[model samples]
Target: MSFTTRPEITGTFGVATSTHWIASAVGMRILEQGGNAFDAAAAMGFVLHVVEPHLNGPLGDMPLLMRKAGDAAPTVICGQGPAPAGATIAHYKAEGLTLVPGSGLLASVVPGAFGAWMLLLRDHGSLPLRAILEPAIHYARHGHPVLPRVAHTIAGLAEFFETEWPTSFATWLPGGKAPAPGSLFANPDLADTWERVLAEAEVAPDRAGQMEAARLAFYEGFIADAIDTYLRDACVMDAAGGRRKGVMTGQDLADWQATYEDPLSVDYHGWTVWKCGAWTQGPTLLQSLRTLSGIDLGAMDLNGAEFVHTVTEAMKLSFADREAYYGDPLHADLPVSTLLSAEYAEARRKLIGATASRAQRPGHIAGLERWAEAAVARAGRDLAAGPGVGAGEPTMAHLTERRGDTVHIDVIDRWGNSVSATPSGGWLQSSPVVPGLGMPLNSRAQMFWLEEGFPTSLAPGRRPRTTLSPSMAEGPDGRQLAFGTPGGDQQDQWQLILFLRLVHGRMNLQQGIDAPLFHTAHFQSSFYPRATKPGHLMAEPAFGEDVLRDLRDRGHEVEVAEPWTVGRLTAAQRDADGLLRAAATPRLMQAYAAGR
Candidate 1:
C-alpha cells in the first residue's frame, strides 16, 4: 500500500470531510443524529462560518453540487448572489475606478451563503432550522480555538482595522488585540444575529414554515436591514487605494434568493463529472477534462514532469476560456454548448506543445471573437499591484501578501445522499463588520470587469463569474464521489489533479489527496488587481528535483512551494457495494475527514 498522510476513512454509515476539523465533526454529528448529507453539509457550512471566519462567513457565497439518494445526476445549488441593482459600470466609473476593488464597500455583493444554506436545508434537508444552526451558534457564542493563520492575518491587519475599519477591529480584535493562536475566540455578535434569526424562524409552526420564516428573517427582515443600514454611508479604503461606498441595498437582498439549477457534466472514461454552471469557473474543470480526454494521461507517470506539464497546459487553455466566455448565464448568452463539445476540445487540445505558451488563447467561436480579444488584451495589461488591506483571497496567502481563502465541505450519508460545497468570500479583511453583525459582506464583486461588452462586465443583478466551485461524479461502476478544495483560482486545478489520479492511477482517496499538487497562474486572476503570469506554475517540493528540473526545462516558470503547501483538498465517495470512504489533505493540518 502507498503511504498516505492519513488512512482513508471507511464505513457504510456516513462520512464528512471539511477544511476545518470542527466543521467535519459537526457534520458527522448531524449524520449521527439522523440527518441526511444535505442536512449535514448545511450544518458544516454554518459551523465553517464561525470556526474559519477568515476563510468564509455567514455573508459569503457558496456553489454546491448535491445528489439525492437514487438520483442519477447531481444538481447545482447556486448560492452565488448577484451584483446589486446599483452596481453598474457607470457608477463604478463615476467613482474613478477601473477595476472593482478587491476589498471594501465597493466590492460588496448581496450576501448569499446564509440564503443558500437555508435553501438546501429547507428543500432537501430533513433537519429543523435550529438543529442545523445550533452547532455554529455554540461555537460562535462560546468560543473556538483560533487558527494560527487566522491570528496571523488579524495581527497583520490590526493597524488597518483600528484606523480604517473600526467596526471590524471591534469584532475581530477584542480587548484591543488580536487573539493569540490556539486561543479561544468567540463572535458573540454573530451568535446573537443567528439566534435572532432562529427566534424569528421558530415563530412559525412547523419545519417548512420555520425554514421559510428563517429565509425571510435573513433576506427581507433584520439581516437585510442591518446590511443596508451599514452600507448606506460607510465609505472605506479599498484595493484601488481609495475610499468608496458600496451600491448594495436592502432591496437587493430582498430581491435575491438562492436557486437550484442543473449542473453541467462531461463524460470522461465512462465517468460523468458534474460541476456548477458557467456562472462559476466550474465549467473550466469540465472543459479541461474534455480537452485532456484526447491524451493518454493514464500512460504517464502521475507524479512526473510530463503529467504536470500536460495538465497545467490544459488548465491554461481552459482558464483562458473562463476569462473570455464564462459568466452568469442568466445575463449573458454563453457558448456553453459549443465550449463543451468534443470538437471544440479536439481543436483546443492541438494547442498544447512541448514548450509553454506565453499567450492567453481563448478559442475562436464565430460571434465571440470580441470577448476572446478582450480577454487576451486584459491579460496582457500589467495590472499587478501590491496587496491592499482586503486585496486578495485567503488561499493565495502563500503569496507575499497576507490574504484570506474559502472553505469546502463534502458529506455522504448512508442512504447514498451526497453534497460537495465550496463556501467563500466575506473574509474579515474583505470589509468592515456590519455594526451588530459579526460577519462582513462579500467582496466577490471584485471578479467583475469594469469594462463594457464582456460576459463578466459589472452590471446590476448580474452574478459575478465566481471561482468557488464544488464537484461531483459517478464512476464506471456506479460509485458516487463528492469532492472539492478551498484555493480561489486553484480550486478547480487541484480538484482536476486529484480526480485524474483517482480515475487513471487508481489511487485511493487518501493517496490521491496526499499526492503532490501543482497549479499554474497563466490566466488572469479573479481577485482585485487581476494579474496574469503567462507561464507561472507553483508546485509542492515533494515532486522531487528531477521532476522540477524537467518542468523548468519545458519553460514553466516553476516556483517550488514548501512541502505539502499547494492544496487543501477533501473528498468522500460511496461504492456500488454500499461502502463509504473519505480523505482530507494534510497540507495545513486543519482539514479532517470523519466517518463511522
Candidate 2:
C-alpha cells in the first residue's frame, strides 16, 4: 500500500480542500447546504480573504479554472487586473526607478479579485450574494484565530508600519503591537466594508440586480473612491527605496472589468491538461508536460536520479521559453499554439543533455528571439546590483520568512461542477491599508518590465504576466482532477511532480501529494529584484543519500532541504465511478480537506 499523510477523503456528495482548514470547512459547509462548487468556492474565497489576510485579501487578483456540468471544456475567469494608463515605462524611469517596486501605491493595479469572485458567484453559483458574503463577514467581525506566522509577520514589519505607513500600523497593530497567536483578532472595518456593499446590493430588485449593485459599489462607487482618494495624495516608500505616489486613478478602476476566456490545453499521453492563457504562468506547466511527453517517464524509477534529472531539465527549457516569450496575449503576439505544438516540444527536447546546462537557453522563436536576447541582456546586468532587485516586496519577504505563500482551493460538487482557483496579491505588507476598508492593494505591477519591445514590457492597460496559475486535467478513465499549489515559481514545478506520479506511477491523489517534492530555481523570478540561479535544484532529503549523490554526479547543484518543507499542494476530484475525493498537503499543518 502507498503511504499518505491522510487517507483520500471519499464521498458521494461533494468535496472542498484549501490551504487553510477554516476556509475548507466553510466551503464544505456551503456544499452541504446544497450550494454548487462555484458557490462553495466563492464562500471559501471570501473566507480566505478574512482568515488568511497575511496571504491574501479582497483587493488581490485571482484566475479561476472551472468546468461546469455539461460543459465539454474548462474556462478561465481572469481577475488579474491591468496596468494603469499612467503606468508608463518612461514615467517609472523618471521616478528614478529601474524596476517596478514590489510594494506600495506604484505597484497597484485596479483591484480585480472582488470583481472576479462576484462574477463567479453571479453566473454559476446557486446561492444569493448574502450567503457568499456572510461567512467572511462573521469571521472579520467576530474574530478568527490569528496564525503565529501572521503575528510574527506583523511584528517584523512593526517598525516599518509605524514609521512609514501609519495607516497600516493602525490597522494591523491594534494596540501598538502585534496580536498574540490564537487570539481572536477582529477587523471590524473590513466587516463594515462588506456589510455596506451588501446593503447597497440588497436595494436592487433581484439576485442579478443585487450582484450588479455590488459590482457598482466596488468598481464605480465608494470603494473605488476611497482607493482613489488615498492613492492621489499618499506618497509612501515602496520596495524601490523611494517614496512615490501611484499613478492609478479612480477612472482606471471604473474602466477595468474582469473577463472569462477559453483555457489553453495540451494532451499528454491520454490526459488532457488545462491552464489559463499566456497572460499567466499557467501555460508553462502545459509546455513542460508537452516536452516530457516525448520522453518515456514511466520507464524511469519514480524517485530515482534519472527521473529528477529529466524533469528538472525539461522544466528549465520551458521556463527559459517563458522568459523569452510568455506575455499578455492582447498586448503582443504570443504564439501559444506554436509554442505548445508537438514540433516545438520535439526540437526543445533535444537540448536536454546528460549534463546539466548552466546557461539560460531560449529556443529560437523566429521574430521574437532577437527581442528576447535584448531582454536577456537588459536583465543580465546583475539585478542583484540594485537594492530591491531579487529582494521581494515586504509581503513577499514575509512569505519567504514565514513560509507563507498564496492561497489555493479545489472544490468538486455532486452535479459535476469542479473549480480550481489560485487567489493572491493583496497582503498586509503588499501596500498601505486602504483606511476604512482595512485591506491593502496588490503589488502585481512588479511582474512587468520597464524595458520596451519585450513581450512582458510595461504598458498601459496590459495584464501583468502573473505567476498565479491554477490547473485542471482530465484522465483517460474520465476522472477529472482540480489541483494546484502556492509557490511563486515553484507552483508548476511541484504540480508537475505530483502529476507524473499520478499518471505514470498510478498513485492516488493523497499518494501523489504526499510524495516528496523538489523544484528548480534556474529561471528568472517573477517578483521584483528578479534573479535566477543557474542549474540550482532543491529536493527533500527523503530522496535518500544515494539518490542525492547520483544527482550530484549528474552535474546538478542539489540542495537537500528538511523533509516536508516544500510544496503545499491540495486537490479535489471526481472519478468515472461517481466517487468524490480530496486531499491537502500536510507540510504546513495549515491545509485541510473536507467532505461528507
Candidate 3:
C-alpha cells in the first residue's frame, strides 16, 4: 500500500495525535469547515483535553512558540502553569516522596495549553471560540472509543491502579481494570467542564472574553476549589501551590490571567526559530539549531546512518547545553544570548564530527553548570544496529493502557497568512478530576527539581522547563515548512530528525516522516529521573540485521522496537503553487493529513 505524493490537502491543514482516530478526525473537520490552521489547532487541542486526559489537562503547563507569514517574529505564549506559591523542595524531602515522578503522579508541571489556545484565537482567528472549542465539548459529552495507546499504557502499569495513592485504583482503573480499545469511554464531569467553556464564551463573546470564561471556569471557579481540596487531602499541596492550599480559596483562582509576550528567537540559515523566555527553556530549540550551524549535514541522507549519526551528535551537544545552562532565566541566569550566538554555535559545532561520538562530554562550552554530574541518561539505549533500544522480541502482551494522544493543527489561508500550534490539556494519565468544579489540575508540577535553589526548583509563580517546543524553518530561497511533534521530550528529537530528513535529505514530507527513526538514549529525562545512555537506539526492525550489526560495529547498544511503534508523532506543511501541501506521520495510528 503506497500513499501517493499529492499536494491537494489545502485551505487548512490539521493533524490529531495518538491512537484516537476520532479525535484527530475532529481536528480535520475544523479545517473542512473552512477554519484556519489556528482554529483547527485550537479545536484539535480542546478535543485532546477532553479525550486524551492521560496526556495533560487544564492543569498541565504548555510552553508554545509560533510564527505566521507576516509576523516579523513568533509570539511566545507561555501556557505552562506556575508552581503554587507555597510549593518548595524541602516539602517533598520532608514528606519522604521520591520527588522524581514518572508519567504518573509527581510528573506534574504547570499546565497552560488551554489558555494558549484562547490566546491564539484572540491574536488571529476568524471562528468564534464556541465554534472552535465545540468539537471537543461535544465529544467529551457524547463519549468516544478507547484508543489502543491508552489501553496499553494503563495495562503496563497495573500497579498504579492498585496504588492507594491519590489516584486510587477505582478512579483510573474503573471496574478495577483498564479500558481496552473499541470500548466506549465517557466522562460526564469532563462534559460538564467543557459546557462551562461555552457558557463563559457567551459571557464575553470576544476573544479575551472567551479566554476569560475559560480561565475563570477552569482555574478560578469551582474547579480550582475542588483541585485545592483534593491536593490538601493528598498532603502534596506544599506552600508553592498558593496561600490557600486548602480548597484553593477564591482569592487564588481570581488572580489567574492569560498572558502573552514577545518570544525570543534567532535566525538560523534563513529560518526564524522562537523560544519562550525566562520562565521556561524555550531558548533551547534556538540553541540546538544554532549548534547545528554550518555542520554540512546536507552531505548525508536523511535517516541514513551518516545523517542520523551527525545530527544525533549535534543534538547531544545541544542537550548537554540544555542540561547545563537551560532553565528559568529569571533565576538561573542562562547563557541564551551566548549559546545562540554565531560564535558560540561555531564553537559548539566543532565538538561534533561526521563520525559517531563514543560518549557525551560536559557542557563546558555553555559554561560549567550541571544537574548533578553523570546523573542523566536516556533508558534502554544500545548503539548496535543503527538506532534501536529493544531486545527485538515481539511482546505479545496486548496494548492495554488508555490515554488521549495530542492535538495539533497548522493553517495557511489564501491570504498567505499562517498559524501552527499544538494546544493540549494533556493525556488522561493524571489523577482523576477534582469532582464537581470540572477538569484535572496538571500533575506535571512534580517535573521540577525537589532540591532547593535549583533553576527548576519549586517556587512561587516559577515555570518548569519543557520539551514542548513549537518550531519553524525557512529555505534560503524562500521555500518553508513549519512543523512539530507531540511526544514530550521526544518532541525535540523527532522534529529535529524529521526536518533534517525533509530539507537536508531532500525527501518529501511523507518520506521525511516515514523514514526509519531512532533517538539517542543518553540524557536526563525532562519529565522523569531516568538516565538514557549514549549508545542506546530505539529503532524499528525494517532496516534489517546488517544495519544493526553495522551500528554494533560502531559501538552502539541496539534495542529493536516493533515497526510503527514508539511515542514520537510528527506533522508538516509547505506552500507551493498557491496551495499548501501537508502530510502526517503514518508510523502511528490516527496520524492523518487533511485539508480542503
Task: Say which prediction, candidate 2 or candidate 3, comes out ahead on TM-score.
Answer: 2
Instruction: Determine which window of 10 residues in candidate 3 has minimal summed lDDT.
Output: 386-395
Q: What TM-score would each prediction reach against the true structure?
A: 0.99, 0.97, 0.84
Best-fitting candidate, scored by lDDT:
1
Model 2 over residues 1-596: C-alpha lDDT tens digits?
Answer: 86778888999899999989999999988988889999999899999988888778898889999889778788999999999999999999999988888887888887788888888877888888898899999999999998877887788788888988899899889989788987898888899999999999999988877888899999999999999999889998888787899999889989988899999999988999999999998888898998999899999999999999999999998888888889999999888898899999999899889988777877787877676686566546677433321224222211464223589999999998999999987888888899899888888898898988877899999999988889999999999999998888888888889989999999888989888788888778788778777888898888999999999998999888777878888999899988999999998688999997
User: Which structure is stronger by TM-score: 1 or 2?
Assistant: 1
Reference-based lDDT, each prediction: 0.91, 0.86, 0.56
Stretches of model 3 off by over 4 angstroms after superposition: 1-20, 32-34, 103-110, 154-178, 205-207, 235-253, 266-269, 275-285, 353-359, 365-407, 423-426, 574-577
Return the clash pairs for model 1, or none: 393-404, 394-404, 394-405, 395-405
Find the candidate with the highest TM-score and give its number.
Answer: 1
Q: Which prediction has more favorable lDDT, 1 or 3?
A: 1
lDDT of 3 by residue, 1-596 (tens): 33533332444334333224555576667666776666666776667665655555655556555556566566666676665555566655554544434333333444567667777777766677778767776766676776666566666545643642235334445677777875766666667767766786678847667766766666666666566666565533221221122222334445555577777767766666555664544465676677776877776545456555666677777766666556666567666677678888887778876456656554554334444242233223331221101111011111123333344444444444555565544344444445553455444554466656556676656666655566666665565465666665556677777766655666766666766777665555554333446656655676567776666666566677787664344454555445555666665555566554
Task: Report the CA-based lDDT of candidate 1 relative to the real structure.
Answer: 0.91
